[model samples]
Target: MVFTREKTLDRAELEAYWKEAPATLEGHPIKVLSGYGPHEVWEGESTEGVVIAEFPSMEAARAWYHSPAYQKAREHRVKGAVYRGILVEGTTPQD
Candidate 1:
């Protein structure tokens, strides 16, 4: 998830998004590789926050993303900030 806050439209809403998203993710086999923290833009423009979550498989990742609980939390995010998000499968090393 990559978030670029044009403006905090609603602090309360954003807070709710933050609070509810993780709770919804509980029990999922996901590993948070990176999340809200300091980062350097080596090239192009960067967003305010970048989050990378690793799952056992693409199906699992999609399941988490589209889950009803997460979709509810996502409502707050949509109302609160400008962002871009995508899911990409990682490449494995060649033998």
Candidate 2:
């Protein structure tokens, strides 16, 4: 969930979101090894930031998204920026 820096979210809060993200899955299925954010939106109607996550499986990913723990964090997320996510299944190269 990318929390655009609206009038509510400040730099410190965004930083806190980064710090607390690890606790979302408690270092189990979720792994966000590296992330970069808060870049200038030199486009049409872009958010203030972006966050990416990798999960062990699609089910795991969905679970984490709906989990109550993450839901609480989601509150902070909603106020922070534009929330967007997708559960996509990977595929091998076509033969």
Candidate 3:
């Protein structure tokens, strides 16, 4: 997820998001690879923040994203900050 700060963040909404979003992870095999860490953008447009997560598959990622619990949590996220989220398959080398 790539986030850009578009406007003043609503702290209440963000607090709610942080409180609720993690609960939606229950039973899902989502792995947070990187987030809110020091990093430099080597290319492309600079963003305010970036998060990298790994899901079992595209379908799994979609399932989690579209889940009712997550959708509800996402409401607060959208209100708090602007984000660009995408799912892409990772490359696996063949022997």
Write out the backbone clash pairs for model 3: none
User: What's the residue-level lDDT of 29 in candidate 1?
Assistant: 86
lDDT of 3 by residue, 1-95 (tens): 33334343787997898899899999888998887677787887666766788887888888889999999999998998777787788888899
Please report how far candidate 3 places residue 81 from its true position, in Å: 0.5
Error of 2 at 43 (Å): 9.2
State the lDDT at 51 in candidate 1: 77
- As for candidate 1, its clashing pairs are none
lDDT of 1: 0.79
Against the true structure, candidate 1 reaches a TM-score of 0.84
RMSD (CA, angstroms), candidate 2: 4.0
Model 1 scores worst on lDDT over the 10 consecutive residues at 1-10
Residue pairs in candidate 2 whose N, alpha carbon or C atoms collide under 3 angstroms: 3-81, 4-81
TM-score of every candidate: 0.84, 0.63, 0.83
Per-residue CA lDDT of model 1 for 8-74, tens digit only, reads: 6778888989989989888788988888767776777666776777888889888888999999999
